[model samples]
Target chain A: MSEPLLSVRNLTMRFGGLTAVDDVSFDADQGAITAVIGPNGAGKTTLFNCLTGFYRPSSGALHLQAAGHVHRLERMQGHRIARRARVARTFQNIRLFPGMTALENLLIAQHNDLMRASGFTFLGIFGWPGYRRAEAAAVEKARYWLARMGMEERGDDLAGQLPYGAQRRLEIARAMCTEPVLLCLDEPAAGLNPRESAELNQILLLIRREHGCGILLIEHDMSVVMGISDRVVVLEYGRKIAEGTPAEVSRDPNVIRAYLGEEESAA
Target chain B: MTVPAMLRDAGLAALVALALALPVVGIRTVDTGAVLGLDYRFGWVAIAVGIVFGGRLTALLLYDRLPRGPRRIRTKGLAGRSRTLVRYAAVAFIVFAAALPQLPFSDRYVVDTATQVLIYVMLGWGLNVVVGLAGLLDLGYVAFYAVGAYSYALLAKNFGLSFWECLPLAGAFAAFFGILLGFPVLRLRGDYLAIVTLGFGEMIRILLINWTTLTGGPNGLTSIPRPDFFGLAFTRSPAAGETAFHEFFGLAFSTQHRITFLYYLILILALVTGWAVERMRRLPVGRAWEALREDEIACQSLGINRTTTKLTAFAIGASFGGFAGSFFATRQGFISPESFTFIESATILAIVVLGGMGSQVGVVLAATVLVLLPEVFRDLAHYRMMVFGLAMVLIMVWRPTGFVTQRTPTVRLSDFTPDPGAAR
Candidate 1:
């Protein structure tokens, strides 16, 4: 009944007159898992980019109202978007600082906090009680999150050396360290096994329930999407074809056509 | 890991303190040896001090303290820029002589070489700023050096100003030229940046060779004034009424006084350089360089302005080179484009790279090896260039990251969970 947490109104991104995301709109409500699903080149990633401020949309608007504030996601750039509006995201490809340790990767996500300390100087690089406390708290928070993900033992391990699956897990943990309000994930299940996917499902559920944050996921896994997503938006060729609960959208003719090619002209 | 490392560090520190102090009590004079038809004096103290100095320093290449918890840095100030201020003050006190010199014996000409070594130490530290901290590989850092030397030569020769007056002017001029050089290479990356800088150095050298009116062409600017004490010019004595710079205490001045003054001047410069660089590394721009070195895209995402960051690196680095350049001119009392050759640039860069990119101690060692080693092998000075180049290649092959790489100081570990979405 309350207003949606995130509202994308007629968002369009054009590259040389080719509308990559054309007149697409959707809302992700508070504490709900919203799935954006489509085939390859369906503009799912493009839409995600627009939301995260990586790509400035050519026209229309993308707004996030969360944490007692509203943000024009399309207008903000990368770092400000993460810090100011509490927007966090994972890339389609892992983007961890490879040379840094597992703990450092997470700590960097709390860069704003560590920087705030400035030795002890609150406003500068002088000794101050405030910075020390902030730094300690940031470290504590980083440790707590790493431990929660079962990565506490491997905190000193190099981030790049972690196996593929743990690297994926570490990426998620790093993003969480930012304490984001709206978490956007692109193709989280792309290379995951059933077991990993199941673990991922539980993680998403925990985020929604415990963290009280809305999640926008672009996924191709049908079972996971249908089982977990409270609402689904289907896009094909940069245009939205259906918006409904997973069951409703699964049965929609347009959605079916986008996936299976018109059912071979069911004459 | 904790107990063993602490014990090892304690032992090493104790050993280092004793070894460094032994020379103070034992060696009061230099030893002389005549070999291969040349006058030679090799002090065991010099080589012993060199080893202990190198030993105490190379330890960093082996162990870096990564922050694990809240105790790595002691901060009693506010939580922002105040931390930066206090850090700078601490570093300054340790590096500079609060706001400020040394000894010389041996062959008369050896002092010039020693003085030159001191000058290169300052220059090495300066280049370390750009190549080490900023992760900007410069093959032509000598271009700034050239700018400074020529700035002094042109200004002092034409205007007849004292060497001290030309010092600040040379630095400002070189800094201006640094911005000029930095502008075009802003978009360049890696080898391209190296190539552009290499070309820039060549350009400066060729200009010095051909710019007859200002730089004196092949003849070079002659009679550049040596660094002098006010009203004193390294004289052995002065009249009772007139105070000689070295005779302030009424003692008969010796050649040792001039060498000591020059040694002390370069030492002060080197200390100032090391301190300034360490201070800058802890500032906002300092952190910006580290971030940009690690990931440029992430740096931009963090709202760091890239252009200013790059320019600051260039300007600061060039300023130091200029200070050294003016000092070089004053020390040698001659200015020629040949002195600022491509080899000079290569040698300087070699010092920075061999020292371990951003490590101050590393740069000093590299400079000592590169500058003093050949002098030690004056018998093979003819083949010194060949040996130097070969050593550089071998070292790079041994440690591709350089002798000591810049490490972000992290000191402790903690438990933290990452965003599960981060996997995507």
Candidate 2:
């Protein structure tokens, strides 16, 4: 009943004649998982892009309220949406800095905070005590996240060489290092096996419970969606055809028809 | 393997040998007393063909006989060992370079050549920041170098500024130019970025050539003040109210004193640049650069300001180029636009890339090889470039990633662990 953390109003994104995300509207509450599920080309990823400021929507308003401040996502730049709005994201394809160690990847996620603490490298260069303290704190924070992701022992290993499942977890850990009010994950479980998916589900649940940050997930895997998501929004042909609890959305005839085309259902 | 496969490989080898030998053996010109005659060095060609054929057959046989798994494991082990070896080699090289001028056999030519090598080393380190750490291909890095040289030349000549006074000013000017170039080409990537930067370098050069009133056109500025030892000039006689450096030290005035002094100056400057770059690599901004290099979109999504990150890399990198440029101007006592040609940029860039993009030790090693090799092969004359080109090709073929490809992670949660696989 309380106001949601993020509110989207009539978000529409069109490319030439094709409408990718057609007037989509949704609300994601704090400390809850909202899963957007649809078949291929259903614009779930497109919606995430618009919300994250990667794409300027043709017409839309995204209002994010955090710490008694409101950010107009549509007006902010991509980096501002992440830094000022405290929104973090992970790509569908893992985007870890391949040459960097696992620890450095997490540290980079805290770049802005560290840059400020170091007086943009001037104070740090002179070994200012305050800057040193901040740097140590950053290392500690990075260590805690690495331990949480169960990659503490692999902190020195190059990120690209980590096993696929571990890389996925490191990506999440990196995003969490930014201490975002909202975390957006696109297909975090795409290539993950069932066990990895189960681990991912538990990690997301723990993040929500402990960190109290809202999660926006776009997942093609139904098990991950149905298992942990508090609410599900299903899209078909870029339109929000169904939205409800997992069981309700599963039973909805429209959702069923969208998954299994009408021709197959009729046959 | 099968007999037919062996026969086919033998046939291919024969064909390759024939093709290789035809040019050297079939087309030959010989001189006779009266006119010209055609002659062939078939013996030499036959020997070359035999070596190639034998080497290929032996390699094929060995490859077939050896197990692949153990070879891979051995290479991985070697990769780990080589990293430590490289570290030791770098330390030894530094020690050698520091002691070169002090050595009994070090003469003026040796000291002078070593100083030139240090300049390229500094330039290589500067370009490494943009091309290697930041992953911005900068084909026009010489523009910043030129800016630094001209800034120092103009300042010292017109305003009568000391070399020491003009050093930082030149760096600032170069950094300004870096940001100027960075702003317009911020959106370009890869080859497009390369072309734009290449054009930017040419623009600076062409402007320097045409702007006659300020730059003295192609004639350039001359008699720029050489760096003094504080207020003391390294000359035979003392100026008004000041003693010459050698007299102040109670040592006889030898021209070698100034040459040696200049050598040490460049060495110190180069070491400072290297130290600063190494320190910055550990700082937040440097890590941001590496991250941006890996994935620009990911960097933006993680709240990193891409524009600022890139501009900072350019500015800082250019400033070092500026410092080196000013030193070059003071060293030569002159400046000309010809020194800031595209080939200068290419050579510095080659040093960075050939040394292994982000490795400081690699840059030093590469600069030494590039600068010293030609001087060492001075007798080879026209053949030196051919030899240099061949060596580069061999290096690229043998170790495509570079001589020192392993990257030490900036931040580590635990004690450093050498990951052999991280070399890539």
Q: Pick by lDDT: which candidate is best?
A: 2
Task: Flag regions of model 1 displaced more than 4 Å.
Answer: A1-3, A66-79, A83-86, A110-134, A206-213, A222-228, B1-118, B147-183, B202-242, B275-287, B359-361, B405-409, B414-424
What is the DockQ score of candidate 2, to 2 decimals?
Answer: 0.59
Question: TM-score of the B chain in model 2?
Answer: 0.83
lDDT of 1 by residue, B1-424 (tens): 4646655765576566456545543344444455333323335545555565556445543454544565443322242454465468547744543222222235556656656766777888888777876778888889899888888877877888887788889999888988998999988879999999999999999988998977889899898766567757676655566567666756666766766677668777878787777755654446556656766655544334567778878888999999998887776778788798888888888788787777776776678678877777678745575566667688788777665553544424632234344322
Off by over 4 Å in 2: A263-267, B1-91, B415-424
Relative to the unseen true structure, what is the C-alpha lDDT of residue B125 in candidate 2, on a scale of 0 to 100?
Answer: 93
Largest DockQ belongs to which candidate? Answer: 2
Prediction-by-prediction clash tally = 60, 0
| Positional deviation of residue B370's Cα in model 1 after best superposition, in angstroms | 2.6
> What lDDT tens digits, residue by residue, belong to model 1 across residues A1-267?
488989999999898968889999889998899999999998999998888777899998878887678898888866678778777888788777666567666666766665655641224344355755565566666677766677777776667778777788887777888888888887777788998888788888887898888899989988679879999999999999899999999999999888988665557
